[model samples]
Target: MEQFYTDERNVQILIALLKEHGIKKVVASPGSTNVTFVGSIQQDSFFEIYSSVDERSAAYIACGLAAESGESVALSCTGATASRNYYPALTEAFYRKLPILAITSTQDESKIGHMIPQIIDRTVQPLDTVKCSVHLQTVKDAADAWDCNVKANKAILELTHGGNGPVHVNLTTTYSRNFMVKELKRERKIERVMTYGKFPDIPKGKIAVYIGSHVRMSKSLAESIDLFCETHNAIVAVDPTANYTGRYRVPYMLVAQQSIEDENRNPDLLIHIGEMSDMAGIVGQPKSVWRVNEDGKIVDRFQTLRYVFEMPEHLFFEHYSKSLLSRQNTYYNSCMEKCNYFWNNIPELPFSHIWVAFRLHNLLPMGSVLHLGILSPLRSWGYFPIPSHIEVYCNQGGFGIDGNMSSLLGASLVHPEKLYFGVVGDLSFFYDMNVLGNRHVGENVRILLINNALAAEFHLFKQTNLTKVNEIERFLSAGGHFGCKSLDVVKHLVEDWGYEYLTASTKEDFEKVYERFITPDLTEKPMIFEVFTDVNDENEALRRMYFIESSTRYKVKNAVKNIIGEDRMEIIKKIIKR
Candidate 1:
């Protein structure tokens, strides 16, 4: 006999997570909007469900069950006055701290204020009614699905968080009649842990710690992470902004996606720390991701989140370092071997941002501070290595292009004796160029503005890949702005502002001025090298660095994708996977 579930993505995710969390007892009230959720669970024998004609009675019954069993009990109700009836019992559960989950199904949220029949505004709930609330909309894309997963996990986790109380999950349904979908897709379950709480034992497999853009690294935190990586046979994938000086730190984000097929690339257990970097899906597809943040919120960036350790990152690493579970560095060695291979095999690229970083990264003065602007510069410099003593910063915590120059100026103020470098694109440099006039600006500032005359990031990579290259410049890249790379625009300003400006239009020009820009000594005036290049050359450099020309399989897959479209290609891939 075949089992079926609702085709609605959000509903399916809810059902899957409920099963994963083992909240099998359900009290369901009869209604149309909630039919998909109730019907799907009713068919699954794993759920022991009770029915009630009154929505108010259904919620009280769930509260009673949860109180008696000392476990979570789920309640479901449809739209209109039916969901309003659950407030009294939810209030009681909230005060008494009973573990109950109230799932109220509703029509599209857009219909709420239009005076449409059966649509009510459930967004504002009484503060005491539940401990937490998360409204789940229909899942549309990977990001939306990630939201649904995190919210569903959050709602479920609230049942046991702090004390225990009822939580609301306002689910918007599409009323889809399709129930032919077989087997629920596996969902990510998040287990939250705190200090003095039970911790998960180390699993035997390839493990890696991925740290994102951290502003500064304390000495103790660095040592704890180093010992953990060494003890657990693991590696640390990082960006320049990660600021982790451990021996195992691999700033391989530029080449991370290319290692999808390598087993070592997809760590079995990946621990993530700090805030996000601009590189989306840079860690490849991992088996599971465990996040350690003091805030303890579920941020399922990779969509594979399984644990959220609510403590300092160093504590999480130190806790696991005492595992005493014997391990070897085989995983670390294997990944580093492939990482080095990828670096050496990178094809010769055109004179572009990546080329500039490759030529200048290692040559930077030691113990200096380096700042990279948004996406392209980070991707370029992240591929190369700087000295361990050089600290790195990027505006990626906000992931904006507004304050690259200002931030560099601020950092250089305190460390006037040490050199500071700002590597930014033209748009970002001009956007925050006002910082150059500040009286506190120091002579240690070395700015390298890569002026392609537009937002070169928007013109390359997976961004609107099907859009024509020429058309991209018109709108997406916002080309023909920013003085159109006028040689004198920046030069005139720098000279008037009492700073040295060097302009370069070709590789030879950059080579000729390289020595002056990277010289270790502090100069009388701050210096800037505004290197100009063509957007076509930037795209070429990215294509070569990503190894697009060498991947015949990727070429064929993309060709098929362009012909059949992404949706159909996804279906074909799913069929092949099956």
Candidate 2:
């Protein structure tokens, strides 16, 4: 049989990244599962191989090689009883600060609980054994390949990150007999530049700087990003929680609703910054993504990550903005011009979450704090803007329906004199309703409970498949829970609990009650404003996001969808595309 690499993508990525990280030394033990890994590297002259028949001796040999050469050494062995021998050597590497890549190849993990031979659960390791361990599962798609690429890079990087230490790669493999493969497909290598390294040259293309759930940007950091945007013709795509109130900051949630093929909307390079974010319902596929964070760990959100600049985001922008000549803002202007189409047109919507958001978005008093429930409230309000002085917060960390009200109440405690407002669904309100009885809730706390008696989020986007089934309300949407949006149910309970309850069942009622609910002035008692709507209207309002009411293109498409029915129109679209 001709020598070749394994068809297994997980092992392929690990082997590729090892060479990319410049690791050449290895100690391999005889094994069935790791034959793919050890076999692949053995044929290449790039690796200086040392064979150890005993798995116990291989890890210790790796430690010695790494320590003496002052370079990372790779160790390979099979699963079950093989990797247990690595602990003592790994612990030594952990304490002594030596970089050792421990590769433990395992048979299919699903066979473990089925009483299959040579199967064991090595999912966890002792704290002192290694600095970090990442398990790479079977790669079936681009997402899986990207995940393997990232995990491999992190395990390799940890060899020197924060101090040298052993890192474990618990890789799962599907046993394959075919071995005619000629080459290792080129893999994505993400280079992490340290503070001492020079920043790479910016690629000349349409650049998008994505700012997700970031803390408030300092004046200098904001200025750095602004100058970079001006110099490089870049635009900042702001997640609602990004809090980057700069001239180049574009409200992107609505713009994201546009077509992905829109050249004016998509970017060639997407520079990601800050924490995990709600990128649901977004469009456009960037050619590549680069992440910037202080932690220096690889976070491949878009799967096309090319580099990770592990430093302060301000330093990255400031370094890039050094230009003697001023550049044009054509890219930024193009994106904003596309976004303005949705902003300038205000369509008449039925009483729904988005309708309420449109009415109350700019009406909220400046310098106030606004807390929102996840899913519906975040998506609705993301289409608009909050004043830079108004601090926006949510349980975006957990993205749960619970604790939204609790978060608002607790945040109000920090500044009792400042107005604190919250917009939560009836489901969230009912789950955390017990908190209302707490006497500590003050007059500064204001709550808006939008009660549609339906799980609008669960049903809206899934209308296609879910509607094909029956009895979806009870289970799919979890609808008709907690008083089923009865007008008196909450009003009576809250009133008795020392809260001033205001209920709105129609747009007229909302018009009458909304002014007092959002008043910046504090009332004698904490207030609850409950607005009610129908499930149909809620879904319709959400569907309007796809069709800008003013555009004749979308208007005609919407008409077709209505006339021929959504299901048939979808079929027609598929045929048209083909």
Candidate 3:
């Protein structure tokens, strides 16, 4: 009779689990400790095994195979320093998110301190090298067999779970020489599904969808989302970059401004979609966040991620929306009411970046596109509503000041006929000043450069901690990095590049030249409207805006303080106390 493979129970259980999960490709490196595993699987015609003498080359081969085949590949190696050779390739797989499984066979770990020649403790790999690590116990009895089977399944499943990466399974074997087992032992198989196979039941409670920076959605997807919001009594909150023009788009600025006290506006189930968003500063605290993405990774942006629905956004929203009863629009109405109230009660002030945004909010031509810089410019314009036809774009992806002008220039190239306006702070403007010299800049591109002489964000009230640091002027705020602070430096540069340079220092100067800058009539050259404002007025304008968004009591107190002046109000308070 023909001799069969080894009857080692742990090896049999692991092989059975691997086959059950449809893992058919096994890359085996020559070794003694893994002889039983290799020899057994080699006999099983179900697996197509490839032999490699070098463990390092074997790992790269498996990575290539998994990448091309779009299937998980398993690499098996013997004990000693053989598994260490997999470090370089495994590190590449980990970073690339390739699903490679490294199965290292060894003698009992207890033999490590005994100076056993061929044993190395691979209890753990380097940090983030693998998604997870599992140590398989020797299968001696039914309990041990079941534990081994479960662990093997878990290790394999983890290879493609959450975010795909490599996983390690260190199997302990006794080197049994019995090679007469004809049939492998039957074992239970565990399967994990990251994507939704069917529509899950919608959670009962207030549901809200928060969309981050995303490209424009198709009309059908927008309509479906709108229907979902209508049917489920849900609202879709978005920052300006969300690019969604759906009816359910809530006034996020008002919601963000009132986030401190709006308990009802907070969603019990917050479904987050899209990429990163800067609206975390504005949205109310959520009780739970359910992230929907194809990657299925657990992204806890709100510190309340309970479920990760790994699927396309439209499918998840459409399915979940169908299973809900309609909810009241009270939350939506309250948000709009507060937004209207703030817009009406905003205080007019001295010339500043925000003051320009307030004045030009209604004046921006219909159907024009607005591109804003990352920090101060984006935040300032977000307070006012833009025409629905007007699309807004910003560089919040890397959130750096380096590419603001370059990105706006690229967009202008695509739509040369459409008017494009970019609002940028002086730091961002100067960082990408070379783009201004580009020959492709057309007459349709207009820029609003807010030159406050320094990085005003470092001087905001909330950033008081940064301001307290020593040498903040040079290091933190980037003061005096460029030459002397004046528009003369900018004027000389832009005039040589064929730009219509316009300067505004006071409101009178701004009103005189602002109309010509915003006019739809195309200019012979691209224009640069540089508005110079004092740092103190910019800080005070921001503080007063926050006070306006505060509670009714604060609004009343601010009004009284403005009417009576600060010194007289303090004196009256002291007199009342006496």
lDDT of each: 0.85, 0.84, 0.82
In model 3, what is the error at residue 156, expressed in angstroms? 8.9
By TM-score, rank the candidates, best first: 2, 1, 3
Which digits, one per residue and each the tens of the lDDT, describe model 2 over residues 1-578?
68888888888888888888899999999888888888888888899999998877888999899989999998999878899988989998899998988999998777778888888888889999999999999999987887888888888888888889999999887877556677878777888887778777888788888888888679899888889888888888877778787888787787677543366555788888878678622425777888899888788777778888888998888888888348679987877777787888757788998899999988888778888788888888998866667777778887778888888999899899999999998888899999998989999999999998877666675468776667777888788888787878998999999999888888898999899988888899999999898888888887777666557766687777779998998798899999
- Candidate 1 ranges beyond 4 A from true positions: 1-12, 24-30, 38-69, 88-96, 138-147, 174-187, 257-261, 280-282, 323-328, 345-349, 461-471, 548-578
Candidate with top TM-score is 2
User: Which lDDT tens digits does candidate 1 get at residues 1-578?
Assistant: 45479899999999999999999999999999998999899889999999999988888998889989988999999899898999999999999999989999999888978989998999988999998899999999988898998999999998888889999999989999888898999987889999979999878787888888886899899999888987888888886788888778876665565623555567788898979777545567788889999988888877788889999888898988885456567766776776676776777778899888888888888788999888888888877766678898888877898998898888888867989999999888888888888988888998998998888887776576634666777777777887899988999998999999887788899889888999988999999998998887998887777663335565687788889999998898899999
Clashing pairs in 3: 256-282
User: Which ten-residue region of model 1 has the weakest summed lDDT?
Assistant: 546-555
The TM-scores, one per candidate, come to 0.85, 0.91, 0.67
Which model is ahead, 1 or 2, in terms of lDDT? 1
Off by over 4 Å in 3: 1-158, 161-196, 258-260, 323-328, 481-483, 549-578
Consecutive 10-residue window with the lowest summed lDDT within model 3: 191-200
Better of 1 and 3 by TM-score: 1
